[model samples]
Target: ILSDETDPNRLHDLKDTLDRYQVYDSAQIDELVGLYLSGADRDQLDPILDACVAAYNVGLDEDGQVDFKGKAKAFARTYAFVASILP
Candidate 1:
C-alpha cells in the first residue's frame, strides 16, 4: 500500500506495530527450481506451482514437457556409451 499514490492513509506508525523485521523463507522457490530439473511431469508440478502463484500473487509459466525440445543436438561422443548402459 505504500507504493500506492492514491492511498496516503494506508501507512501506519511503525511504533504501533511489531518492532521486529520479518524474514520469509525461500524454500518454495528453491524446491520449484530443483523439481523442474528433476524430470518431474506437469501433473506432479502443477499443484506446487499453483500454491506458489497464490502465495506470491504473481504469474508463473508452467514447465514444458521434458520429452520435447525446441532444438535437437547430437552428442555423438557419449551417445553410444550411454545408450549401451541403459536397458
Candidate 2:
C-alpha cells in the first residue's frame, strides 16, 4: 500500500495496518504512475486520467505529465491488487 502526497507517518501507519506491507512514499509512487501512464494504452488510462483531470482540473505539463495529488494511490491499488492476484 502507498499514498501520494501523503504524510510519511500516515503511510507507515497504513502499511503497519496491512501486516506491515511495504508502503512507498509519494515520490516513488509518482514514478510508477508516470511509467504506467506513459506506456499504457490510452484506453486503459482513460478512466484514471479522467479521474485525475476531474481531481486536478488543470492542464498537463509541457512534457505531458499529468500532475495530481494522490493520483498515485490509484495506480498503487491497481498494481497491488493485480500483483496480489497473480502468481
Candidate 2 per-residue C-alpha lDDT over 1-87 given as tens digits, one digit per residue, 9 for 90 to 100: 343443435544434443222233454457558868689766665665465455344444432332222334544564565567558
lDDT of 1 by residue, 1-87 (tens): 222343222222221121111111257557766788998788877877677445333322232211111111122223344456558
Best by TM-score: 1
Candidate 1: which stretches are off by over 4 Å?
Answer: 1-25, 56-87
Q: How well does candidate 2 score on lDDT at residue 44? A: 60
Q: State the local distance difference test value for candidate 2.
A: 0.47
TM-score of each predicted structure versus truth: 0.33, 0.24
* True lDDT of residue 67, candidate 1: 13
Query: Candidate 2: misplaced stretches above 4 Å?
Result: 1-38, 58-87
